[model samples]
Structure formats: C-alpha cells, structure tokens
Target: MKQLRANREKGMTLVELLAALVLVSLVVILINSVFLFTEKNADSLSKETDVQQNLLLGMKVLTKDVRSTDGEQVTVEKNRLLLGSDEYAAKNGQLLKNGQPVAGDIQSFEVCRPPKGAVYREDELACKPLIAGEADENRIIVILEGTANRAGKSRRLSAMINMER
Candidate 1:
C-alpha cells in the first residue's frame, strides 16, 4: 500500500480569514444603508400619496354635491359650506361633511365665486356668482378651493361645478 505524504499545511491563514471577514462586513453595511434609505423614501412617498388621494376624493365629493343642488341652495359662510341639507365645514383642523369627518389634515376649504373674482363673504352670500355679462341664469356655477397637508408638505384642490334648477 502506498501512503500520500502531507506537503504543507492547508486551510486559510489568520490574515486571509480577517480580510475575508472585513470584505463581507463592508458588503453587509452597504446593503443595510441602501435598504435604510429606501425605507425612508417609501415612507415619505406613502404620506404624499395619502394626501393627494384625500385631496382628490374631497374634490370629487364636493363636485357631486354642488352639481346636485342649485346655487340658491348652497351657502358659503366664513369657514363652512352649506349644500342643501348637507354641510361641509372646517373645524379642529379637519374637514367634515354633514358633521361627519370626510378628510383629514385639511389646512383650508373655501368657496369662491369666480365670476365676481372674489371669495364668498358671509354677508354677501348669493345664489349665483354675480357675473358682469348677461349669461344664462338657469345654470349657476361655483368654485371649491381646498388645501390638504401631510407632514410638512401640502396639496391644493380646486373644482368648479355648475348646477341647473
């Protein structure tokens, strides 16, 4: 029987092992940093998307309501909008529709009379936006302006609706 003799010691040396460990740690650290940055970016993007969706939903609801009712039925007060039996108001930094919360983080909600080029005043509220030209009186249109915010950023929404009695 022939036996093989060991030529030299095998396996990784201490320095080689240490170098491998350092390389692995660096890769791990880089991956961790990238994931951390991605997480932060995703969080911010989620907040922004939420605010935008809320603003769009709010505008849609307002438009539907305005279109269903005549201008004479909707009243624009200081910080509230009355549409027939329903009311949309801003209170406690929230927007409410008929006393129920419809949106959050609302900075402002206003009803504007574009034809008059002015916001509706509590004392000067009108059924139809006063226009200089002699236009159709059967249809009246109004504007709803709103602002929604999340974190430190904000978004604005504007909707114009025309109603015919």
Candidate 2:
C-alpha cells in the first residue's frame, strides 16, 4: 500500500489538471481584455493628437502667409481671407487654401479685422466694427475650429496675424 501511494502521488490527478487549465484560461482572458481596452484608448488619443497637430500646422502656415503679404493686399471677411493671390477658407469640413485642402476635419474658419489697436484677451477677440476716427489696423484675427471624427474630440485655434509688408 505504501508503494502504490507513492506512485499515485508522483503526478497530479485529472481533476487537478483540469482545474489548473481553467485557471490559466481565465488569466489569459483577463489579460487579453485589458490589452484590447488599452489599444482602443491609444487609438482614440492618437487621433485626437493628430487633429491638434494638424490645426497647429495650419495656423502656422496661415500666419506665415499673412505676415508675408502687404497689409493692402489682405482682405478679411466673415469666413474667408485673401492674402494677395492666395485665398484661405473653411469649406465642407476642410480648411482650403486656393481651393485645395490645407487641412481636414475643420468645422469653421473665421477672419476679421478687429477694431483698431484691439488686443486679444481670454476668449475675447472683440471683432467689432471700427470707430469712425480709428485708423485701420494692419492685423487680422483668425479663428479655426475642428473636430476629430473617430476620437470625438474638438480643437480651436485663435491667432492675430500682422501683415509686415
């Protein structure tokens, strides 16, 4: 009886093996779920970041264009700007430069000549009409707003661009 008991104790029983397998499967399932959740979040965040960077780049290009053009060659309207022969606008959810897409996922683009000597404050562009005696300013206020489709995120950029020429 002692010899038989020693042989049986040399290995796990069928029930114990099955239980171990079940435990391992449960652990694998839990880890897989966590990995999938993390992947989804990472994708969403990446999309949001892409949208933000695109907006920033678009703003930089617009600023460069405005600064390079002469003040007399600049035209500001409610939703469009013309810097000499170059035209910038937001249309059909895109930021367009001379009818070509500059950036995608844009919601709105607004251009205005703020009152003379007006300054930008927190959320206050103050794009009001100029007073009769006020001199025309050599700058423009541009606002760009956009949304990321899959990420459900939005961003806005406001700039005061000065025409140097």
Candidate 3:
C-alpha cells in the first residue's frame, strides 16, 4: 500500500493537468486582447491621411487665390493675408478666403513675409513699407496648419508665392 501510494503521488492528477492548461489558455487570451487594443489605439496611418487631405484642399484654394491676385498692394499679416482683391484668414475651424469658407478642418492659416529686407532689397527691409503709400510686395510664404478630425493628428504645409503684376 505504501508503494502504490508513492507511485500515485509521482503522477499528476487529471484535474491538476486540466487546471494548468486552462490557466495558460486564459493568460494567452488576455495577452492577445491587450496587444490588439494597443494596436487599434495606436493606428496613425489613417490619421495621417486625413491631415493630408485637409492640407491639400486648403492649399488648392490658397494657391488659386494667390495666383489670381493682381499682386498690387499686397499685405501680409499673422492670421490674414491680402493679395490683390482676394483675402485669406483663419477662423472658426475653417480657412476663409474673401469671407467665404473654402476649406474645413483647418486650424490656422498664416501669411508670413520672411525677413529678407536686407536680402530682398535694402528698400524692402523687414516689414518696412516697400514704398510709402504703395503696398505691392514681392513674395511671401503661406502656411496652413490643420488637424485630422478623427485621429487628431496635426500637420503644417507651406507655399511660397512670388507675386506677379
């Protein structure tokens, strides 16, 4: 009887083996779920596409406005730009040109004149009037900043426009 008892103790019970198997399976399932959840949340490619689309739409409109402008009395501002008769501004989650919303999901539009007064020309130095009473300028950089509506990814795009008379 003692020998038989020792042999039984050396072998694992059926219940013990089943319980171990169940625990391992459960642990594997839990780990897989965690990884899937993390991957879903961290997906950034879709967000990048959204931001790119917004940028393209905004840039298209801005390009047309910049190109069609008469290029006379150009005015550059932080949030607004005046080229010929067309005007662009950043307002209310949209890009506005001539008081009409041209692009949506745009957070900001900036029209900056690079400080090239010394480089552009001595007379046109750094925000100084090119010619008193004359507002026509040469070139400017337009920047559009936006975010994806769903993913919330923020991006910026810029273009340099050489004003033509």
Candidate 4:
C-alpha cells in the first residue's frame, strides 16, 4: 500500500489529465465569447457615430448660410433651401451646396419659418415652410436627419436660425 501511494504521487492519472483539459477548454471558450461580444458592440457604435457626423455637417452649413444671408433672398422649397447665392438641396442621400456635395448620408433636410408665437422644442417642430413669397426676415428652423446604417441608428438636429438682418 505504501509503494502504490508513492508511485501515484509521482505522476498524474488519466482522469486528472482529462479534468485539467476540460477546465482549460472552458476558460478558452469563455474568453472567445467575450471578445466576440465586444467586437460586435464596437462595430455598432462606429456606425451610429458616422450617422451623427453626417447630420452635424449638414446642420453647420445650413446655419452658416442662414445667418449670413438677407432674409429676402432666402427661399424655402420641398427638400430645398436657398440662401442668397448659396443653394442647399437634399437629393440622393446627400446635401448639396451650389450643385456640389456638402454632406453625404443625409436622409432628409427640412427648413421652415416659425409661425407667430411659435415655440421650439427638442422633440417636435411645428411649422410649414413656404415655397414662395418672402421668408421671415428674422428666423428659420432647420432640421436634418441621417441615413440609417447597420446599427439602425437615427439622429436629428433642429435649429432656429436668426438671420443677420
């Protein structure tokens, strides 16, 4: 009995080797799953960020044009807003300025003059932009929406632009 015990202590049995292998295999599987999950989340976040960037780019250009133009020269149409010599139009998933692309991946662009006693809110905008006639010489509302990507993210930016006389 003493001799058998001494021999057993010198080397691991087949059962022990199998148990160790099983433990190592389980740990590897857990690590792989975590890595895969993080990669997927990162990819999703990148796409969402791209959508927001497109919206911001379009918004910045619109605000600049509106602020610089004389209100009389501004014209609002369906998916089109013109400020003096600068033209902004939403067509084919892009925002065009002077017949050149200014922002891509744009889903929609809306511009309108606020009504008398109109209240602006982050969640909703209530105004109908006139296609013809003199625009309000003071302010106009602009809204931009981005195209949905693989992340299925949607973003919107709205602003009440005050024209510089």
Candidate 5:
C-alpha cells in the first residue's frame, strides 16, 4: 500500500522578505538623518556661544576701566573715548598722538574714533563740548558695536562712566 505525503513550507515568501528589507533600510536612513541634524545644531550653538563670550569679555573690561575713571579727563570724539588720570590714561581712539599716548598732568582718558561701519551713540553728558564749559555731573555713555559673523547676528554693548567730581 502507497501512503500520500504532504509538503510543508517553513520559509518566508520572496515578497515578504523584500518588504522587511525595505522597512529596515528606511528606519536606518531616518536615524542617520536625525543624527546629522543634531550634529549641525550643536556646531551652530558652539559658534554662537563663542561669539557671545568674546563680546561679554570685551564689555566687562571696558566697564571696569570706565567706572574707575576717577579724576580722569574724559574726552569723546565720534566713537573714541579718552580717560586720563594722573597715573595712567585709558584711550579708545583712532589716532594715537606721537606714537605715544597724549599725556595729562592729571588722570586722563581717551577713546579713539570708532572704525568705519561701527555704530555709536553717546549720552547728552558725554556729547558736551570740551571747551570752556562746566562739566556735567552726568555719566558718559559709550556704546560699542560688536563684529557680526557670517550668520548676520550682531551685538551692541554699552558702558557708562560717571563724570562726577
């Protein structure tokens, strides 16, 4: 007597195999894209941080000197500021006199004319005429413009130096 035998298949069909391969490939591609985007964002953030730090440091140093400008003659010309004291002179001017600083018997300060394309605005006190006029008891305003990067982001920082006697 002959017995009939049934065939059993235990493997996936070609279509199912192809579908799984495609899904896995898509997931891998999506993950890679996310990583790339994150990396780019991190790099941009770093650049911005660096720029901010530089600007802040510049402002702090300038502010300290301005606040300590006691008995110092303050001169403002366009974008420059000069603070002169008997001991030392602080200058932020465009032209240095005689390759040496312009000296004064008392403490003196000077700010150089700002470079072209730099924006500046002074307070009423700071803009007072340097002639035969009583010095105003108000503080001087000094605003400095920071260099912009390729991203077109710019920063402006200001310092106020009291001209109080």
Candidate 6:
C-alpha cells in the first residue's frame, strides 16, 4: 500500500497534466497577441508621422510662394485664383513668376484644380495651377486646405499665407 501510494504521487495525473498544458498554451497565445497588437500600433504611428511631415512641407512651400506674389490679379472664378501680370499668362498649369524660378526655394505660387461647373470644395482631381508671382515683387494672402492622415485618422489643416512687399 505504501509503494502504490508513492507511485501514484510521483507524477501528475494525465488529466492534470493536460489541463496545465492547456493553461500554459493559452498564456503564451495571449502574450503573443498582445505583442502583435503593439507592433501594429507602432507601424500605424510611423505612417501617420510620415504623412504629417509631408503635408507640412508641401504647405510651407505653397504658402511661401503665394505670399510673395506681387502684381497679382486674383480672380475668384469659381475657386480659381487667376493671378499674375499681362506678361504672365494665367493658364491652368502655368508656374507664373515675375522673375526666374527660385534656385531651390519657391518664390510665388497658386494651387487650383480644373474649373468645373461649380467650384465644389472637394473636386481636387484636376490639374490646378501652382502659381508663383514675380520673384520679389508681389505680396498677397494665400489660403490653403488639405487633409493630413495620422494613424488611420485624418486631420484637415487650413492656413493663410501672407507675403511681404
């Protein structure tokens, strides 16, 4: 009887062993899932950061160009800004400037999509002009709007650019 009892207590019963194994497996799976979730969140954050940075840089370039515009003839022809001088034709895709294009930085500019029937605020799929007025002559206000995405969320940024005379 003593030998039999000792043998029985020497190892875990089959059912107990199975239950412990299942518990351990579950814990491992849970930990793995948590790690995966964290990794996904980090990836999303990285993408968001990239988009925000690009949007800001693009906006800065555009605003600088708009504000530095001189002798601007702004025509609100359905959300289109027809600015520049007679010498500079305000075409749909012209990069107008009084002087030559800036070496590395933009001097003056405008952004507009093709003129549709009504200037819908959301028809941004057309060839808009990124206009830049005279090199250092014009000074005006430029309004900009765009969407910046971050971590699966979208943010709208609107800014006004004022150029010095």
Per-candidate TM-score against the hidden true structure: 0.68, 0.81, 0.61, 0.79, 0.53, 0.53
For candidate 1, the 10 contiguous residues with the lowest summed lDDT are 136-145
Residue 91, model 5: Cα distance from true site in angstroms: 15
Which lDDT tens digits does candidate 2 get at residues 1-165?
Answer: 899989878988899999999999999999999999999989888877777777887888899888877789888888899889999998888889999998876888888877776667737764566655574558788888878557465788887777655
Report the candidate with higher TM-score, 4 versus 5: 4
The total number of steric clashes, by the backbone 3 Å criterion, in model 2 comes to: 0
lDDT of 3 by residue, 94-119 (tens): 88888898777787777766644434
Per TM-score, the best of the predicted structures is 2
* Whole-model lDDT values for every prediction: 0.64, 0.81, 0.72, 0.80, 0.49, 0.44
Give the true-structure RMSD of model 4: 3.0
Please list all clashing residue pairs in model 4, or write none if there are none: none
For model 1, how does the per-residue alpha-carbon lDDT over 32-55 read when each residue is reduced to its tens digit?
999999999898777777767766
Highest lDDT, which number?
A: 2
After superposing candidate 2, which stretches have Cα over 4 Å from the reference? Answer: 7-14, 126-136, 149-152
* Model 4 TM-score on a 0 to 1 scale: 0.79
Model 1, residue pairs in steric clash = none
What TM-score, to 2 decimals, does candidate 5 have?
A: 0.53
Cα deviation in Å at residue 38, candidate 6? Answer: 1.2
Question: If ranked by lDDT, best first, what sequence of candidates would result?
Answer: 2, 4, 3, 1, 5, 6
Q: How would you encode candidate 6's per-residue C-alpha lDDT over 1-165 as one tens digit per residue?
A: 899988878888889999999999999999999999999889877766654554455456545645555635434332334445422222322222343321212222333323223232333333344445422223223323223334334533334333335
Tell me how far the alpha carbon of residue 6 in candidate 3 is from the true structure, in angstroms, after superposition: 21
lDDT of 6: 0.44
